[model samples]
Target: MRLTVLGCAGSFPGPEAACSAYLIEADGFRLLVDFGSGSLSALQRYAGLHAVDAILLTHLHCDHMLDACTYVVVRRYAPDGPYPPLPVYAPAGAPDRIATAYNISGESVDDVYTFYGLQPGSFPIGPLQVTVDRVNHPVETYGVRVEHGDRVLTYSSDTAPCEALLRLAQDAHVFLCEASYLDGVDNPPDLHLTGREAGEAATKAGVGRLLLTHLVTAWGSEASTFEAAASSFDGPVEIVRAGARYEV
Candidate 1:
């Protein structure tokens, strides 16, 4: 399977940056992990607007999901006649929640997207098998594990260090984790992981690689975050770059 980082900015986007989106492709199927603020534009750099086959939203936070509003418009007004509703797997009430974010009613957005409630379980999206587990976050977030044949890729959408994340990331070829806080800072609990915590999780999970995302540059230097993770994990680790690609 191949993974692409369309965007990785955290909280809010800086100039020319976008927040929290990923593209996972295998067997010609494109499964979008999240479509956050400013991601729609970035997505076009990798694939066509209509190329996405399905979507999986980890949580309802705007920084992680709001650009789905723009996605609705893209499919709803495709030069071709309105296309079939795209499948979207998300938390309960996502239809109403995203519609509200877009200032429209759920019924209107429903025209372009079909909603499926995300629960803790395993399911299939095209050729990929996905397992989701609740993670440590303010909202109802889920960390995901995707399998294509024997390859595995895990994503820690937005979370603090937690057992569920460790289990989901267990033995994954690539652990795409979030490090929103620096190592030596006063950070709130149950919101985000520091680079050290992320690396610790990777070490415990025995993942092949640790790729840190969701970094808010205002908090500290990216190099410092890299140092923090490398201090804990004795494996390939790096601060993920937007538009970077990975094979898992």
Candidate 2:
């Protein structure tokens, strides 16, 4: 399995990166996790506009899903004519929320996307087996674990420290986690995880490697975030870089 970092900036796009988005490919199947703001353009760097086979959204936040609105336009009016409705798995009320965000009337959004409400369970998407668990976030968020053959990758979409996240990350070959807060600063509860927290979670889960992501540039330096994570986790830890690819 191959994992590509499409974007890693938190909350909003930074000067060098977009918001959260990742591309996972295995056995000729392409799956996209999170289509955040500015990600559609970045995605074109690595894949054709229509190459994505399926999408999984962790939550409905603008930084995580807003680009999906623009994607509808691309799919609906492409020169080849409208493509088949793409499968999108997201939290409940996602269709209505996306319709509202896109400001489209009637079933226009539905014409481009076939929405499926995500639940806490395991399901198969092409060659990958995915397990979803509810994480600690204000909204209905899910952390996903993807397994293909002997390889496993876990993504902590956006969450505070929680048991569900640890369980989902257990024994994962790569733990892609969000580190949105400064190490020693105070942050709102049930919102995001600090680099230390993310590292600790990875340690507790006994993951093989930890890749820190979702760094809010305004909060502090990215290097400091890496330091904070390394302080807690004894295994390999690195910050995610956009356009970088990892084999799992």
Cα lDDT of model 2 by residue, 213-234, tens digit: 9999986788888998999999
Off by over 4 Å in 2: 104-107
Best by lDDT: 2
Give stretches of model 1 more than 4 Å off. Answer: 104-107
Query: Per-residue lDDT for 102 in model 2?
Result: 84
* Candidate 1 residue lDDT tens string, 113-232: 899999999999999999999999988999999999999999999999899999999999999999989988789888999989999999999999999999999767789899999999
Candidates in order, TM-scores: namely 0.97, 0.98
Q: Give candidate 2's error at residue 12 in angstroms.
A: 0.3
Each model's lDDT = 0.91, 0.92
